[model samples]
Target chain A: MITLDHCHKYFHKGSVNEVYALNDICLQIREGDFITVIGSNGAGKSTLLNCIAGSFFPDSGTITINNHDVTKWPEYKRARFIARVFQDPLLGTCPSATIEQNLALAIKRGKRRGLGKGVKNSERDIFREKLGHLHLGLEERLLDRVGLLSGGQRQALTMLMATMIKPEVLLLDEHIAALDPKTANQILGLTSDIVGEQHLTTMMITHNMKHAIAFGNRLIMLHQGRIILDVDGTEKSKLTVDDLLQRFYTVQGEELSMDSMLLT
Target chain B: MTLYAALGAVEQGLVYGIMVIGVYLTFRILDFPDLTVDGSLPLGAAISAVAITGGINPYLSLVLAMGGGFCAGVATAVLNTKFKILHLLASILTMIALYSINIRIMGGPNIALLGTPTVFDAVSVLGVPPYLAGVVVFALFAILVAVIIIWFLSTELGQAILATGDNPQMITSLGVNTHTIIILGVGLSNALVALSGALVAQNQGAADVGMGIGTIIAGLASVIIGETVFGTASIARAFFAALLGSILYRLAIALALGVEFGHFSFNPSDLNLITALLVVSALIMPNIKKRLMQR
Candidate 1:
């Protein structure tokens, strides 16, 4: 579980170009809660996730993961409870390293690393078994450099790496946005399977409304550093995109103007 | 070249090979363009020479020299990671500061080890010919260093260092303090470089304040040449490549200095020029071969 209370993050404070990225934010994520987050550019969806991820501390307020206060924890220090997959495929995996080596890194996530052999002979079978689950034939290329893999394959591998060691929280930030539609669908399907199998507490940011609505148990819409909509369970399942747009109009008192969000 | 000259070149190669491997660890593995070696190498020499002249055991002096280099490297890493100095600038700062430190350590600009006992003395007692003593000892140490490096790179900590260089963000998300990894990596790299410097000072029987001048350039040349010639398809192969590259680089320098063309000869002053040319050719050779193959 994760909790954020009255958090605020401002960029370029006191400067003419100042902007509030996260403002007066409070959130609580329950164990095994898969929450899908939706927002347009500059809506603070990423800022909210980043605050929880400890990329930077909030200007005000506290964050707790499973009851331990982590407001001031650095990103690496908090990584014990969190795993993240970036939008750019290259950002998630070490390209020059072999597939097994990358997986080996994941296996020791949030754990002390010593001078022992990184990839044991016995671990090869485990890695192969896990890679086989991706259905990408990566197991056969265990020794191959990750850079040689396509963007889709790499993203899929990243997702597997993130969940293999079982983090308390998993953050997916537009992870499949850059892939082809066919690959995007494949990754999305994989995401669903993995989340369901592990019952992972996940927060996935997506530009696609259909995905945001279709995947998670809960959905929250962010608008200008505020949570404008939160829907879950039956209400979320019964609601349509039109309902979401009308709700946005009613809540913000204006028509939704983000064309990319509308188009997606 | 004559056999003695060739042997001398090989001896120099083995001694400097340790420095080349250190360069590979930082520039290639850690992705830190550390200029600290320029100072740390001489720092090691200064410490070893001073300690040796003060009646300390030669082998223990090498350890002291490595420890000195480690501190210098840690200083550079801290300046970069903690103080937020640019990595290149931080290393340069350490290097410049070491110029003063090395002199203070030796209490002079140079220390002569002409009659003092050295590590090679122990090897000489093993019945090796006097001329071959340096070569045998240096070869044994070089191979030992290469083996240790190869083993270290396969370890869990080594993998973390590789990941830190490859993708700091990814490694951080995996729960690694990249700052700590960098500090350890850079420290180890400079330690080996200092070890090389100490051995070189003993082999040639003198430690000069300026001995570390052009150290980084030569180490980099050896690394690039090793990668180019040996192909870094694997970590073990890369280490061996670096060692052999150092040897090849020294041999090339010796050959250049020995040859004459139409009454023209390369002066010893042309060492840096020769190193630059060697690195350039090694770097471009791969691309040229690729193009030729395409044709």
Candidate 2:
């Protein structure tokens, strides 16, 4: 579980171009909760996840993960309990490294890296078994550089890496946004499968409203650095794209004019 | 080239191969363009020469020299990582500071090791010919260092270092501190360069302050030439290529200086020019070959 207390984040503070990225936000992510976040551009969706991931500390706030206050920890230190899959497939894996090497790095997450062989003979079996499950034929190309994989395949691999060791929180920042529709659906299916199996506490940001409603048990809508809507359980299950848009219009007094969000 | 010159070139190549491997670790593996090796090479030589003249064991002095080089490398890494200076400028600052430090360590511009015992003296008792002793010893040390590096690269910590160089964001998300990894990598690289310097000083019977002037350039030339001649398909192969490239580079230099066509010959002072040309050709040859094949 993770909790944010009075979190506030700003960009270019005190300058004329200053913008309030996250403003006086407080939210608690419960155990086994898969929360789908939706917002238009500059809604602080990424900043909210970043503050929890310790990419940068909030201007003033406290974040606690699993009962430990990690607000001041550096990004690498906080990574022990946090796993992330970035929007850019290239950002989640090393292009020059082999598939097995990348998986080996994931396997040792949150653990001390010592003098043992990076890819042990025993771990190769595990990697093969896991890659086999993805059905991407990556099991046969463990030795091939990740650079040779397609964008969809890399994103799938990134998803696998993020969940290989089930962290306290898994953050996906538009992880499948770059892929085509079919690949995105496939990756989304894989994400749901893994999250359901592990009951992972996950926060996924998506631009598509249908996906925001289709996936995750809970949904939250952000506007102007504030969470204007938080629905869960039966309420989330009964909601549709129109209901969410109507609610947003009443709260913010403006139509959700992002065409991509409406159309998707 | 005469047989004597050929043998001497082989000896020099084997010794310098250690330095080339250090260059490969920084420039290729860590992707850190470190110039500290220029000064660390002389720092190693100075420490070893001074230690030997002061009555310490010759082999032990090599260790001391490596320690000195490690400190120099750490200084550069800290300046870059902790203080946020550009890596190139950080290494240059360390190199500049080390010039004065090397002189202070030696108490002069150079140290003579003509009479003192050396690592080569230990091999002379094996009934090896005096001319071949230096070659045998240098080859043994070079191979030993290469084997160690190859093994280290396959380890978990080594993998983290590789990932740190390949993609810092990916490794950091995997819970590894990239700053610590960089410091360790740069420090290890300079230690090897210093060890090579110590061996060179003993073999040449003196350690001069000016001996390190073109150290980084020659190391890079050897690395480039090795990668060109021998494909770097794997980590082990890349190291072997670097070592063999050093020997081949020395042979090429010897041949260039020895051969003459009725007053057309290269002078020793033209070594840097030759190295520059060799690197440029090696870098562009692959592209040229691809274009030729397309045509």
Candidate 3:
């Protein structure tokens, strides 16, 4: 569980070009809440996630992760309870490292690494089993460099890696946005399967409206550094993209403008 | 070349092989083009020579030299990471500062260890011929260092170091403080370079402030030669290749100096040119092979 109280993040404070990336905000994310977030460019979706992940500290207010204040924690320190898969395939996994080596790194997530063998023979079976689940034939190619894998395979590996240690929170930053439709669908299926099996507290930022509506138990829409809509369970299930658009108009008292919101 | 000359080259090669391994750690493993070795090598030599002149045990002087080099590396890492200085610039700054530091450490520009009992002299008491003593001592230490480095690189912390170099963001997300990893990795690299410098000072019986001027080039030449020739499919292979590469590089230099080529023999001053040519060929060898294969 995570909570943000009156969090504010400003870029270039007091300067002429000042911009508020996150405004006064309060959010309470419950355990096992698979939250799908939808927003347009500069809507603070990423800024919100960055705040929770400790990439940027809020100018005001506190971030509590399971009752521990983590506002001052560095990115690496907050990683003890958070795992992230970046939108860029290259950002999530080490390309030059072997598949097994990447998995080995993931297996020790949030833990102190000592002077012991990285890829133990005993752990290889677990890695193999996990890789086998991806159906990417990466199990047999553990020694092969990860750079040689396809983009979709790499993303899948990254997802598996992010959840390997079962972090307190999993953040997916438009992870499937870069893939082709077919590969995107496959990864989406895999993401759902993994999240369902683990019941992970996940926050996914997506540009695709269909996925934003289809995947998670709850959906929250962000607009101009603030949450505009929050719907869940049966209310979330019965809603359509048209309903989302009407709600956007009703909430903001203006017509929806972002084509990305409707096209996806 | 004569057998004695070949053995002598091997002796020098084995000693510099340790420095080549250090170079490999920064250049290949960390993807850091650290210029601090130019300073750290002399720093080690200066410390060892100074310590030896002060009546310290020759072997113990090497340890002190390594400590000095580690500090130099940490300074470079700190400048780069904490101060936000570019890595290359920070290393260059360290390298420049070390010039004065080395002179200060030795109390002058140079220190000679004439008549002092060195590691080679200690090995000579084992009944080995004086001509073979230098190579034997260097080989024993080189192998030990190689084994330790290989073992260290296989560890979890070592893997994190590798990941830090490979993907800093991913490693940071995995809860690794990449700043610490960079500090440790670069520190270890320079320490090894300093150790080699210390050994070289003992072997040649003197440490000159200018002794480390082209040390980085030579180390890079050896590593590129090693990786180009022997391949780096595995960590152990890569480490051994670096050592082998250093020996071969020394032998190549020896061969170059010895070859008359119809009155065009290479002199000592042409050593830089020779190193440059070797590195150029090594850099292009894969491409040449690939082009030939297409035919």
Each prediction's whole-model lDDT (CA): 0.93, 0.92, 0.92
- Rank by lDDT, descending? 1, 2, 3
Candidates in order, interface RMSD in Å: 0.5, 0.6, 0.7
The fraction of correct interface contacts reproduced by each prediction comes to: 0.91, 0.84, 0.91
Worst 10 residues of 2 chain B by lDDT: B120-129
lDDT of 2 by residue, B214-233 (tens): 88888898999999999788
Off by over 4 Å in 1: A249-264
Q: Which one wins on lDDT?
A: 1
Better-scoring candidate (lDDT), 2 or 3:
2
What's the ranking of the predictions by TM-score, best on top?
1, 2, 3
lDDT (Cα, tens digit) per residue for candidate 3, span A1-264:
899999988999999988888888888899999999997788899999988998889999999998999999999999989999888888989887889989999999989999989899998999999999999888999999999999999999999999999989999999999999999899889999999999999999999888889989999998888888888899999889998877766756544445546777
Query: Can you list each candidate's DockQ?
Result: 0.86, 0.80, 0.83
lDDT of model 1 at position B234: 86
Residue B132 Cα positional deviation in candidate 3, in Å, after optimal superposition: 1.3
Question: Which residue pairs in model 1 clash with each other?
Answer: none
For candidate 3, the iRMS in Å is 0.7
Number of the top candidate by TM-score?
A: 1
